[model samples]
Target: MKQLLILGCLFISLGLIGQSEEETEIKNTINSFFSSFHAQDSVGMTSVVSKNVVLQTIGANKQRQQVLRQENFNDLIHAITSIPDSIKFEEKLLDYSIQVDGPMANAWTPYEFWLNNTFSHCGVNSFQLFKQEGQWKIIYLIDTRRREGCANQP
Candidate 1:
């Protein structure tokens, strides 16, 4: 009985450890998404996202647009490259919640983007990630952004 209990505890501990590692990897994947954007690394960004990825942006002008497929990817690459390298945008992942079931995961991360040290916007990024061949890749992303009023604090 004691041996059985020990084995059970070991199994539980291993499961917890595995979960912890997965969480860390997820966070890294999220971080990589932003880092790629900041660096204007099109290839790097594309590698993490799904081939049929969808991106939607809500601009300050109140215009909502959707980007799909290769055209979307090209547009993003162009937009990022157009930005002057001096105009640094720093993204902070303030909070994230993830749900995993089998080979699929969904994550929501509340984030703040800073441009030249000033808070530019805040939003919650929703991501649908799938485990493909033992790797996690973002299948869809829909992020909504709103300007930060003075009343808001990051």
Candidate 2:
């Protein structure tokens, strides 16, 4: 009976380890997605997104309403690449909660983007990720954008 108890404890420990590994993998995948954006690595970013990925950016501009697809990925890549390296877009993850179910997962990452070390905008990014063929990929993303202040609007 003692041997059986030991075996059961060992099995439980292995199961917990496996769960921790899976969580780490998912977190890494999400981090990679953000890293690609910061590096302006268009190809790398594209690789993490699904072909049918839906991207939405909400702000005061109409141009932000367009849906992004694989066909226009290059254009988006070029746009990001055009930003001067001196001007940085940093996303600080304030809080994030992720849930995984079978092949689907959803994550909410509250972030603040800084420009040249100054807080420029802040928003929350909602992501829809899918584990397809054993790899996690972002299938959809919607982010809200707001300037620091608008009281002085013209």
Candidate 3:
């Protein structure tokens, strides 16, 4: 009975370790994508996404009607790269909520967008990922952006 108890504890510890590792890897994958974004490196951003990844944004149109804007990955990359060097922007991500099941996971990140060190908007990002070939790759991404109803903090 004593040996069995010890083995049981060992297995539990190993399971916890596995979970910790998975969380770390998931966060790392997300961080890598942002790092690439801040650097304006299209290739780096593309490296972490699956070929068929979907991108969308939630925003209000000119008529104030809410709409989902689906974006092409390449077009986004082009836009980012085209930004003038004189301007600087960043999406500061706050907390991350993650869940995993087998080979898929989802992460929710609340963020503030800053332009030239001034807060422009705040929103949340939802990222869906798939474990492919032993690595996590982003499969879908959607985010909300709002100027009002946001606690803009530096």
Candidate 4:
């Protein structure tokens, strides 16, 4: 009985280790994407993203009505690259919750967007990734943006 219990525990430990490793890899992939985004490096950003990736956003319009917007990947790249050197922006990730099942994984990240050293908005980003040819690549990304419920908001 003791030997059987030990063997079972060993297998469980191995499985947990594998899961932890996968989670770390997924987090790294997302981090790489954000690093490229902050640098405005389109090439670097594309390296970790699938060619057919989808992007979307949920936010409020001028009248405070909620709206969903779908963005073309190429257009997003162009917009990022077109930013002037005088402007600075960042998405500060507050927390990450990731789950993996086989070749698919989802990462939920809450973040605060800052522009030119001022708080702009806060939201949560949902990133879906796939393990393609042994490498994790982002397949879909969506986020919510709101001026309320921000940590630093007055």
Question: Of the candidates shown, which would achieve the greatest lDDT relative to the real structure?
Answer: 4
Best candidate, TM-score? 4
Give the alpha-carbon lDDT of every model.
Answer: 0.78, 0.76, 0.93, 0.96
Question: What TM-score would each prediction reach against the true structure?
Answer: 0.81, 0.74, 0.93, 0.98
- Please, what are the lDDT tens digits per residue for candidate 3 over residues 34-145? 9999999998999999999999999999999889999999999999988999999999999999888878999999999999989999999999999999999999999998
> What would the per-residue lDDT of candidate 2 be over residues 1-154, giving only the tens digit for each residue?
9999999999999988876666666777878877887898877888888888877776655564534332355566787878898787877777778777778888888787777777777777888888889998888888877764422222
Ranking of models by lDDT: 4, 3, 1, 2
Each candidate structure's count of clashing pairs: 0, 0, 0, 0
Error of 4 at 109 (Å): 0.2
Report the candidate with higher TM-score, 3 versus 4: 4
Evaluate model 3: give its lDDT.
Answer: 0.93
| Regions more than 4 Å wrong, model 1 | 58-71, 148-154
Clashing pairs in 3: none
TM-score of 1: 0.81
TM-score of model 4 vs. true structure: 0.98
Order of the predicted models by TM-score, top scorer first: 4, 3, 1, 2
Across residues 1-154, which tens digit of lDDT does each residue of candidate 1 receive?
Answer: 9999999999999988887777767777878888898898888888898888777664455353433222376688788878987788787888889877767888899888888998888888888888898888988787767775422556
